[model samples]
Target: MGTALEDSEIYQKFARITDSLLSPEIEDFKDSGGKVVGFFCSTVPEELFTAAGMLPFRMRGTGSTSTELADTCFTPINCTFPRHCFNQALEYEFEFLDALIVINSCDHIRRIYDNWIDQLDEPEMIHVMSLPRKTGDRQVDWYREEIAELKGKLEEHFGIEITDDAISDAIKLHNDVRRLQRELYELRKVDRPPITGAEVLRVMVAGTALPKADYREMLQELIGTVRGLEGNGDHKARVLVTGSQLDDPEFIELIEGQGALVVTDATCFGTRLMWRRIDEDEPDPIRAMAQYYVHDRPSCPRMHGDQPRRLDFLKELVEEFKVDGVIGERMNFCDIWQVEHFMTGGDLKEEGISFTQVDREYILAGKGQLQTRVQAFVETMKGTD
Candidate 1:
């Protein structure tokens, strides 16, 4: 398992950005290419970037703040990811970046684009996009428009034109990935998912970091070897997880280890990005993309706080995924999720969803603590079965 931690120590250190740290990777990329764009989302449309031949990298926000670096550029009220990254960028930590793209996937992202555009002077092209949250024709049309608008932006900003063939080729690569991931998810539906939650997280993160073609192949190989029998678990428990900014996989591994699979989840890094992408032939990508945000299984703390909507989404997940219980994974210091954790936890209790809460951290070395929590939850969920 080439976990995220498998990388060099320097890379891991770089991943944790407080508002104070200067970002060398961000800066160096700028220096190398002179100008490149950043995509801040769980998913960026690979087709557009690949066709354009421009350097595109995913912005993985740690959601931690460095008060010294970020204080002047972002309001304290903003999300940590926005405050920290924007703070560093304003100080020229990302001077090499000529532009950035933000999709309307969450409140923090919307705020990030608005504040960033307002701060940067001429020559900075900030493209704010609307992402369609659901699947089908309405979605296809919206994503099509999004692709076109993005194409136009590339033309205007990079002085490079994106052709229809490029769009088609990009879509094909992404679609192949989509198909394989869907198959892999189906394999996970079994009693024993071959790849661990940590592994799954790695694959998903690579979805952002690696090229689409490589990621799909890696997943296909990893998912093929079913982990065989689960060493833990009471043999039964439906599990549901709710959280925000969940790019890490330690917690997911814990719950899965305990004898239950994470059939359903509500997190910023999961389905919110997983289910969304732009295809080649969608006529109106922007409209399709915009509606995806409103119509999909809305994520907590980000969407409207209507208690019923929260419960409905949870209940539906439980039923569809056949979950036995629910787990809310909060990071040790994630303020946004800390609040949502309570709201979602309370409503879940009211609706009679068996559940537990764990405050997890991002440090990759502590696998033992994670395994313990997961074992206990699985045992609890099994409940004398």
Candidate 2:
């Protein structure tokens, strides 16, 4: 039954986009004189770019085969995610972007801004935001100022104005995207989900690649299509995945291939991107966006003093989705997520939730080992049941 949904035309369209760095929609958008601003972290607001009449692209290393070229610039011990992304840039995979935006989410990601400025010739405009490590009123205010600064840069560089009304409209448009995504996630709460985790990831990653309006329409059609199909109940265990910046559906597919249904996740590219909405009625849309993005959404490890809140959020998802186990997968050398995964494994175990931790490369390299670990974990869950 899940296969029926995965085989649909719309689902295939999403998969095609997720499978590559450049998509046809992006090419068409470029052809139509639309500018694209590529960003690294989820903390960077996409609405600001939309308000500026430019597409906000979430950068990823989807088709990267190796970090060979990037290794010359980055150390061997750096997190592979950013290394692969920089490799993609070096290979000219991201030449379509008119500008690039980065945030100080972590040391590994923050380095991209320095290296990009020194190395890249394309993406004429490169900017980075200094995000606060703690959440507070002052921090939110600071972030709002940062957003305003970026907005001003866009307006000045592109010879356009990101008016308050345009920002408000962009907020409303993105809120619709969030609402539709929440609707799709609601379907995953069932005993048997019509859509697989890999398929859902494909859809989510597609959102980062396509224009918000086009992605919203495709999501609407997809949610309607999925609702009509029967659910797939063939998996042995219900699992929730959490950890480092995951953008590849193949990693999720590897876990699901081991007879576990990845019902939900707390990863950057997954629920974290769509879980919260910006207040549409706030007279100051930038402040509203700052409040929502900085304080309201789920906190990743980069945000200090939020570990308890993150664990609580994961536990809530476990209860709601009836998750049998949690898999904490992090990229090697990601100090923040490494600490988070350690604490999460111990904390979730204290609550009697089964937890397994995996260390993976930026690209999917150790397939046999990952498959073995996942298979053993699923078997253990089955036995406990």
Candidate 3:
């Protein structure tokens, strides 16, 4: 018989949400007169949208199978993630979104904003945010001002006044989400976790798709159920996955299928977004958000001069989760992560860690090759033991 956690209604809901681009919750939210604002990157403070009575959606190219339409605008050298995203937009896959806020995370991603405005018709309220390349006092201040500008734009577009009190309330609400996710991650620290890495990825992706309050409630239920169940002791090695925008659960499933359990990850869609909490007590909510998003949280490769900090955080996860090997997966032609993986591979080797890099498309493909590599890596680790 399966465990209660495996058969839970909430777990099923998470899978259903992740399997599609527009989930039932999103359709219901829209039907009830709620506006949804899709944002490209994690750097965008979601609290602002929540405070302004809008749903903040973390945009992904989940269901995209081809970049046919987007190919006319973009070259083959660009990352496929953004190509698939733009393809989805061109196909009217994201027509439900009332607005889109793009961030200059990279040249390819920033191009989406331009292409979107030129092509799309329904989502008239499109905005672009300039993200700082490095972290510093000046950058923090600059981000804070940028956030304020976003707030002003929301107010102007929606005719809604987002008060400081409302932003504070939103911060508290999102912080609750961060706390619950962290608690869920803590469960993975055990030798035999009740939950699998694929399931955790589904839950994390669902959080980005659904309403915050609803997602939080489901997470609390999931954590409670999974905590009581006996852990699964059916894996050969524990692996830590880290790299570029991985929102697909099947990729983790592929790795796990090769006799390795993906215990944890440092990907943007996973730990990077949930690892840190914003200050609830800070008087200036915008400044607090800017500080947390820009400075405090785990920095992605786009942030210059932060590779050392990123490596330190990855090493800490390896120790905490008892990771056997680290797999660094990056999308093809991702210049930033290509450099990051090269640096990380050498650095991790110097620390006496097992590391391998995998280059893949935005959509999951080449499973046989990936499986062969993963199986060899797992067997190599077993041999070392």
Q: Which candidate is the best by TM-score?
A: 2
Q: Which regions in candidate 3 have their CA more than 4 angstroms from the true location? A: 1-4
TM-score result, candidate 3: 0.97
Q: Candidate 1, residues 1-385: lDDT per residue as tens digits?
A: 2333334332233233211222444355445564456777653464567567554556654333354565575565555555656665665656545567888766666777777777777337878877665444566576667766887888887798877666566666765776665565555555544434444455555555444554566556544443332322334564667776666565565565665666657665555455444434555433333344344435445443444666677777677666777888775555656776687678777877776777764433367876777678777656545
Give RMSD (Å) of candidate 3 vs. truth.
1.5
- Residue 356, model 2: Cα distance from true site in angstroms: 0.8
Query: Regarding lDDT, does 1 or 2 come out ahead?
Result: 2
Give candidate 2 regions above 4 Å deviation: none
TM agreement with the true structure for every prediction:
0.66, 0.98, 0.97
- How far residue 332's Cα lies from its native spot in candidate 3, in Å, is 0.4
Deviation (Å) of 144 in candidate 1: 7.0
lDDT of 2 by residue, 1-385 (tens): 1479877899999999989988999999999999999998889999999888888999898888899999898999999989999999999999999999999999999988888888988788898988888888899999999999999898888899889999999999998998899899889999989999988999999999888999999999999999998999899999999986798888999999988999999998888998888988789999998988888888888998999999999999999999999999899988898899889899999999999998899889889999999999988879745
Model 2 scores worst on lDDT over the 10 consecutive residues at: 1-10
lDDT of 3 by residue, 90-153 (tens): 8888988988999999999999988888877868789899889889989999999999999999
